[model samples]
Target: MDIKDLLQTAIYQAAHKAIADGVFADHELPQVILEVPPKKEFGDFATNFAMQAARGAKTNPRVIAEAIVERMNETWMEKAVIAGPGFINFYLKTDWLYTMLADVLTQGENYGNSQAGGKEKIQVEFVSANPTGPLHVGHGRGAAVGSALVNLLKAAGYDVASEYYINDAGNQIDNLAASVHARYLELLNQEIDFPENGYHGEDIIDTAKGIIDREGDAYLAFSVEERLTKFKEIALQEKLAALKADLASFNVYFDVWFSECTLHQNGALEKTCQVLKDNGSIYEHDGALWLKSTAYGDDKDRVVIRDNKIPTYLAADIAYHRNKLERGFKKLINIWGADHHGYICRVKAAIGSLGYSPEQLEVLIVQMVSLYRSGQLVKMSKRTGQSVTLTELIEEVGTDAARFFFIMRSLDSQLDFDLDLAKSTSNENPVYYIQYAYARIASIFRQATEDGITLSEIDHSKLNLLTTECEIDLIKKLGEYKEEIIDAAKERAPHRIARYVHDLAGQFHTFYNQCRIKGVDRDLQLARMGLALAVQTTIRHALNILGISAPEKM
Candidate 1:
């Protein structure tokens, strides 16, 4: 059970009893807000219920606080005191902590999961990068954040679908085709001018060579137009395969790889524009169709179809979102790069104009990531000459460190990924520090078994022996696992889980230092062992949510 929630309910009951007892016959109790005190001397948890009910009581808050404390029937509270401004503080008895430890051990991997979301259908679309190049560190960060958010939402009982929108129908694809053709000509000693906007990565040249190995100058037998189409088709397939392989290696898998070309082929864009016209949200001027997005909070009107009779990218996006809503999802969440911050208003406006509440769509902007090695910025990728690819970063540091570091900070804040620190196995590495705690607990269990002690023989009744400050603090932290998961899911923030695991690990280390398990009295040793097992179970569950591994040996 959530002790804070339970205590809040008890406090409300006390206030009700005070009202029935005629202490505040004229008052209606306000909602109770429970908060942890900054200092231990203040209490375990503090609430402002009495202060909020003062107006209804027509008396000073301290009077109401005293009345409620007198009527309180909290069996788990050691004591309750009134602080300045009538804040009620509660110190919990040891039974609550003991019960929490048992709960963690019983729940095991399902410790933090909840049914709070009621299984609302939600779709998270992220890392929809163009299929023109390999994914960079920025894409990697987005992938990590998106995947972790999916796990968090599922743990909170939301029905979620993860998607990647492939951009394969635009000028970028044409440039890719031209670039590959240029490389093929160069390989055959035929002079050709490379397009200025063409892809220059070595992977493009490699793709061209692979085509030559298969066809062998057969492309010369066809017209340049046909060759361009063939080349575009070949490059798109190859790039998409590589993208899928790289993301899978990083442990990110998508339920859907939605294609932009499908939007045009199926006439979804035209259908969406017609819907906007029917709603009078679109107008035509100068042979171009424009959307009055400014009517729905956008800074300015946006063009849906240009003078050349071609639909803009914005047109396709609107259709995509409409498709998502029509698919019966209650909410749509998009994770975009920080550079797209200005794009959020227009998208939300479009959704609003499509007759849906703007609040139905949520956009999260992932800020840029800078890589540092030995205190110096690593500017360019040796392969692409633009930015370091995600594959390179994963190869340099293992997948665990790469995924952990990418989300170690808030999504809106700029992140500096230190290469040297990530590779270190020492305690300075946060991932290693958390994993080591799990490993240490495993070592203790192994040693115990060797000494002819098994968990089955442990005495759980002696748990009250764990009254040390460190031991209590560790159990209290374990109790917060469910709340952490709920808060992270509600806020759409995965970094909170990472921060929680680190704090839990720190508490376990402190408890290990202050308490002894081996060679202690039989009852005391078993109690501590049970606590250790609970800590291990909780840490593993948290790491699984973050998409990080909890190793038995680090």
Candidate 2:
């Protein structure tokens, strides 16, 4: 058990005892707010339980605080006090923290993982960008966040499936094929005008020339319509392949690549529409098919099919969500860009119309990332094909730096990715700072082993000698790991974990600067080595959770 759990257990027992003593009306346990004290003198953990209990007890909060403080009797309990505004602060004994190293060594990488998630079947759909072009920096940020969130959820004991939605059956495919044809014509010394909305990137020219070289004149025999659709399908498959390769290079692999074209091919789209029609959630108006999304808190009714009898993209989305539910995913999470905020309500309304509760679906909209080169925004040119791509950014700065930089901020908060800062791979980079701390400990351990130090034979009682304030501070921080995981999981905020690893690294660095681990008596060396080993274990586990690598050497 972790510190938060330990404190919660005590709070529950105290609340129950107070109820038995007729100090409160209902059996409802009062709210317990456990937080680290602002100053080191305040102790390890502090709670404001008495301030909340005073209303029920009809007395001064300080008296209730004193009453609760008088009841704590665990072995770790060192002292308790009632501070200003009636808060009960806990100062834990040093011995209690010394034993935590045993748990760290025994658990290893599994130190922070827990079974508290209750095992829900969750599907996280993210980075479902169109395959018409290479992914940009915006997509990279989403990829990092989505991958890290999946790992965080899995560590919390949820059964998670990661998915990437492919938007292949759309007008974008037609434009892409036309662009490729125009590029091919240009390559053959024949003048051809590209369509107004065709992709103009140089990559399209290369792909077109490749297709012409491989397929020769075989496409000439087919009719115009047949040629266009076939070329579009082939180009889309190629595009998806390239995307998969790029993501693989970044260490992001999805379990599913659900194609929008699949829904249309299998008649599932039409069938879902019929279900909505039969359920009275859809109606006809002005020769157009409309869904009554307004009944479920949507801003207004939306058209599923236009008056021209062509289904809109909304119709396809409804079918896709229905397919997700049909596959037995108890929870569906979509990581959408913030620009799609308006789509959330209508989609949830559609889910409700499809016989599933709106609660089953969740949408997390990540804000945009502002790209800065030397503290200046890089303007995307309209004519020149010099837009920044994910591959380009990764080439400039390695994948590790890109991934860490992308996830360093909250998803909802707009991020400013500094190119110069990310390119610097030294300790100036926060990623390297954490990795170097782990590396430093690994180096020390290797030196200790080579000097004939045997960690396994170290006596357990010697661990109690780690009574320095800096050492105990680190133990207190380690004790908060479980709570950090729970908070990140519940809040759907993986950035919190990233921030936590940096702070832990900072604590380890401070401890390293203030003390020496080796070159002492055998017993002192063993105790100090145990502390260093615990720090190494924590840094490794934290980096693993974030889907990052902790190098053994700088």
Candidate 3:
């Protein structure tokens, strides 16, 4: 159970009773409010219900606090203290803390999962990078955030679908085909000018050679345009396959790969345009079809179709969202890079004009990831193949460390991923520090079982032997897991989980430094053993949510 939530519920009950007993007027309470005192002297959980009730009672806050304390049951807490100008603080009994360990043991890996989001269907679309080249560090940030967010929402009882949108029928695809064919001709020792706006990455050349080796002469005899169409078809699939493999290794799996081309093929784009046109949201200006996105908070009108009749990227995106709504998702979350911040208004405007509530869509903007190696910026040039690829980072630092490092910062904050720091085998690497806490606990448990000590043999009532302040502090933090999961899911901020795990591991490390578990006292030994198991379980669960692994040993 979540102790904080439980305490909030109890305080609400007390306030309600006070109102019913004519101690305060009705409708005076603020629904619910709970806060932790700034100092330990103030107590574990404090509330200002008395301050809220004072205006209703037409009296001072201290008088209301005294009367409420008189009515509060001592069974729910050790004592009630009204100190420091009428703050009603509740100090839970030590027995309550000891009993909480049983809850932790019973919940185990599910200690923090909450039912806060009910059963809403939420879709998260992220890392929709064009399938023209390998994923770079910026894409890595989105991958980490999106993957972790899916896990968080799942834990919070939301039905989440992780999705990727492909831009396969766009000018970018044409450029990719041209670039590949140029590189193919170069490999065949033919002099040809590279296509304008074509990809220059050496990886593109590699794809060209692989394609030519596999499909020789069947494409060589065709006209350049025909060959390139096929070349792009082949190269786009190949690049997307490689991208998927990289993401899988990084522990990101999507529930759907929505094709932008398929939407156009099925006439969904035209249907969406007609919906807007029938709603009078479109107009013809300068022989070009325009969307009045500016009417719904967009900075300017966007072109849906050019004068030549080719649909713009925004048109495809609008239709794609329409398809998403058709899929029965009430809430849509789109995670984009910081550069796409300006695109948010247009998309929301289009969704709003489609008669769907724009509030149903949530946009999370993930900032860029800057690579630092040996304390210097590492420049990336796709043409030179000198930039760091997501695959290379995974190979160098291992997937767990790479993911942990990438998600350590908030999405709005630019992440400075230090190559040197992440690869270190020292305490400075946070992933290792958390894993070490679990590993150390695993050692203690293994040794305990080797000496014929089993968890079933320990008595729950004897848990009072764990009275150290450090022990109490660890349990207090463990009690916060449910709240953390709810906050992380509601905010779409997975970095908070990383931050929480680090704090829990830091407490465990401090406890290990101050106390020894294997001793002559059996009850103390069992209590400490249980604490170790709790830390191990917390570390494992938190790492699992972040798509990182928690190994029993390094």
Candidate 4:
């Protein structure tokens, strides 16, 4: 149950009744916003409905608060008080806490889920790393964030599909081919110049070596153009396979792996260009076709087709987004690198030019990640040629730590991933600490089972005995789980879920330390056991959404 929403509804009903009874001579009511007060003594929840309605009601806010409070039916609420210029504070009875615990138990793995999204169809495209090199640390961060966001949206009842846009048909592919060809020649003891912008990753060299080992230099007799084309095809497949393997290892899986080449082959690119031209959004300029993006709030017009008759990346992107819309997705969310922030307006402009609201597309820019080890930046990797590969990071820190740490910070904030801290087994490691809470709870249950107590035999009637400060606080945190997920989904902020689970784990630890479960009275022990199970359920749900595991033992 959403307590804040419930309280808001109650307050709205009370205010509406008061207005109908002519207590306040207002024909219109302001939107009610309920919030948790900064201090526990203030109340469980505080609302500024009265203050907001003051101007509409033409009365003092404090007086309006009094009118609403007097009309409020005290069913779930213990009492209501008017405080500080018209805020109404509500203290709910302990019965809601008992109900919350029961809900957690009943919901099981879906304890924190809700139907807040109304089943809107959303497509989340992320980690569309170019098929030129192995996925690096930054790509790993995007993978983690995007996958978790998909999970978050799904839990909130959205029909969400995760997608990866493969940048296969680009100059980058040509460069990859060139790099592989050069490496192939090197393997055969032939001298060839590698392009300055060619991919120099160790993986590319490995691919080249594998080709030579299998084909035995037969390609040397082929024309350079044919050789480059064949090599590009091979390298693309290998790189894509490696990317899939690494992402799978990190527990990041996409529902669709979309090929950029398909856009061109299926004539979507031409179709998109025709739409732009028909809508007067494109113009021929300087021997090239340019989209009049400036008319739609871009910094300037952009080239859709170059003077050489090659469609620019923007053209392909426009077609990709249009294709997404044509597929009947209600929303499109793209997780892009921070460097693409300037590209947002143009993409949005393209959407607008295509007769769709720019609001239909949302772009989340993920900032860069800097790896630190022993207080020093570690940049290079032997496995991925130059940059640290996501596979290597996973190998070092494990998938759970890699995913948890990647999303511990907001996507907009640059992350400093501490290698030492992530691998540490101490409480200083946030993932470890959270998992330890789960393990500790599991141990309690195990001990209970050994003592001839089954979970079904627990005396749920004694749940009201859990009235200590820590117990109440823990229950309150558990109640906030659903709200946290809803807020995270609404804001497109998956990091909020990470923060929530961490905070919940901290609260559970506090309760575990303060309340004894083993030697207490059977009634209190059973009640505490129920609470522990509820916490374990919540932690598991939270971690599951994050694609992280909640271990039964540390």
Q: Tell me the alpha-carbon RMSD of every candidate.
A: 1.6, 2.0, 1.9, 1.4
**Relative to the unseen true structure, what is the C-alpha lDDT of residue 68 in candidate 1, on a scale of 0 to 100?**
85
lDDT of 2 at 1: 68
Candidates 1 and 3, the one with greater lDDT: 1
Per-model TM against the reference: 0.97, 0.95, 0.96, 0.97
CA deviation > 4 Å runs, candidate 1: 22-30, 55-59
For residues 119-228, write the lDDT of model 4, one tens digit per residue.
Answer: 99999999999988878899999999999999999999999999999999988899999999999999999989989998777787899989988999899999999999
| Candidate 2 residue lDDT tens string, 1-554 | 65566877887676666666665544345778899999989987899888887787776778777667666677777888789989888887776676776666667678888876889899999999999988887898899899999988888888899999999877888899888877766776768888899998877877887778898756767776777777787788788988998898777999999999999999988999999999999999999999999999998999998999888899999999999999999999999998899999999999999999999999998899887888899766334456778888788878888888888899988998887888776768899899889999998889899999866856667788777878888877887787788779878888988999899999999998887877777788888787787778878877777778889998
| C-alpha lDDT of residue 105 in model 2 | 64
lDDT of 3 by residue, 245-277 (tens): 989999999999989999889998889999999
Q: What TM value does model 1 have?
A: 0.97
Top-lDDT candidate index: 1
Overall lDDT per candidate, in order of appearance:
0.91, 0.84, 0.86, 0.90
lDDT of 4 at 64: 82
Candidates 1 and 3: which is better by TM-score?
A: 1
lDDT agreement of model 2 with the native: 0.84
| Position 524, candidate 4: lDDT | 90
